[model samples]
Target: MSLLNGIFPKMKMTRSSNQSTIVSLADKEYKKDRPLVKMCGITSARDAAKAAEAGANFIGMIFWPDSKRSIPLPIAKEISRKRWFLAGGVNHMNVCEALSILRPHGIDVSSGICGPDGIQKDELQILSFMKAVHSVHY
Candidate 1:
């Protein structure tokens, strides 16, 4: 990631607790008040739809061949129903505070909802995290 960061110093790279990276190409038009929300580490269409229904601006499917969180192309195709990330250490517990304080144009999340083994995403946590994001209105 440092190498990539060196090459693209303008890009912001976020790494999850599990060491998986999520990179975001931010646009200047992003709104600080109603920021875009990106949910990463999605492996199922169900989760993708859930995030969208919860009002996520984008959903990211991991494609890194080396990461356990990476999904297969077919599954990725299926989840193309939604799209996009790269933020780290975000979860249900602290996301609200982060959003309220930083007021960023968009958010990137990943292992924030992963289970103890850091291999599987927790559906309940997903809900909690989304709900928290929704609760913070500007």
Candidate 2:
């Protein structure tokens, strides 16, 4: 708590389930000099990059099970970068194509990199999958 002592009265980005954007409840002193913006439910890096490009100071990764925008861990990590966020039916077999054609903000995976039970993440599959993505030129 001491870390935030001087900056304790910080503003917060409030959100609701059905919304894609964040609303910062200010403390009157909030200035346009660098308003804090957190782009929520970012599913790709492109979107994140775009948000960053637009002056967003932070990002929110969506992973709520019942929320329509819930993203898989692998995909979230992928987009947690600067650009490109791709999802929907992506897997090892087709990741290369997605990267070559679509490009990264990052890829979201569930069954694509999961074990047989479709719950636990398969490490080798995750590695191989990210390797395939990283191998792409652009």
Candidate 3:
């Protein structure tokens, strides 16, 4: 098993499952009024700043060359101080370990929240993902 799967074995979900079915095994309840939200695949400084202004807890810089949303390192550095997360193919499976290792202010997601089309962000999936993440005590 991959290291992430080993660390967070419960993150896996079948494609047949509904968006609401994605759950986490976190035993602790997050009491915070709102967990930090990080929007990934930011391509421009204007968009990055806009996300920050819109109350996004963190911005994500995509460094993976395979990702359509990937940005150059220089651009990433420009917005490095804006409370950001490094993201590309981040998902529920690796999020727990990523949080454990990086311990950033928040985590970001993209394809994880998308529908089968892999483009449109599904509201139900987003809600479920958020719920799972927020359920973590840490």
Candidate 4:
């Protein structure tokens, strides 16, 4: 019987579930002036270093258990720092969770944001994902 018990009755709460009002990258804006050069399918520390050196604005490391690209948290965190922004998973649901956990500059999703057999992107989900990204200041 906590203060938020009924308000979010079904919420699966965790230490990282709470939202913070403290915005850090408020001054920065996303611009195509410097394109979002992302390194997808980052598998190792070497790959992350290479992507960082290559001037990638983001690097994706899969966290989805089913994906071949998935890497351990320790390895992923090691690759992720102040340098290249880390993106996790190839699914929308996991991307959202990753956002809560990693707080990466950007998020990347493929299958979960798409329809069966990668037919098309779901507009609502895409918008929701983008909104989630915009809500947090990097």
For each of the candidates, the C-alpha root-mean-square deviation to the true structure, in angstroms, is: 15.3, 11.4, 16.2, 13.4
Per-residue accuracy of model 4 over 2-33 as CA lDDT, tens digit each: 32222211101112235421111112334434
The best candidate by TM-score is 4
Error of 4 at 25 (Å): 15
Q: How many residue pairs clash in model 1?
A: 2
59-85, model 3: which lDDT tens digit per residue?
Answer: 677755788887766666554542356
Runs of candidate 2 exceeding 4 Å displacement: 1-83
Question: Predicted candidate 3: what Cα RMSD to the true structure?
Answer: 16.2
Clashing residue pairs in candidate 4 are none
Model 3: how far residue 125 lies from native, Å:
26
Greater lDDT among 1 and 4 belongs to 1
What is the clash count for each candidate, in the order shown? 2, 14, 0, 0
Report the lDDT of model 2 for residue 80.
44
- Ten residues in sequence with the least summed lDDT for candidate 3: 7-16
Model 1: per-residue Cα lDDT over 22-115, one tens digit each: 4333233444456446677777756755665565666655544567777655655544521243245678887787566544444666788887
Give the whole-model CA lDDT for all candidates, comma-separated.
0.58, 0.58, 0.57, 0.54
Model 2: weakest 10-residue lDDT segment is: 1-10
Worst 10 residues of 1 by lDDT: 3-12
Compare the candidates by lDDT and give the number of the best one.
1
| List of clashing residue pairs for candidate 1 | 22-86, 59-83
TM-score of 2: 0.41
Q: Which is the better candidate, 3 or 4, if ranked by TM-score?
A: 4
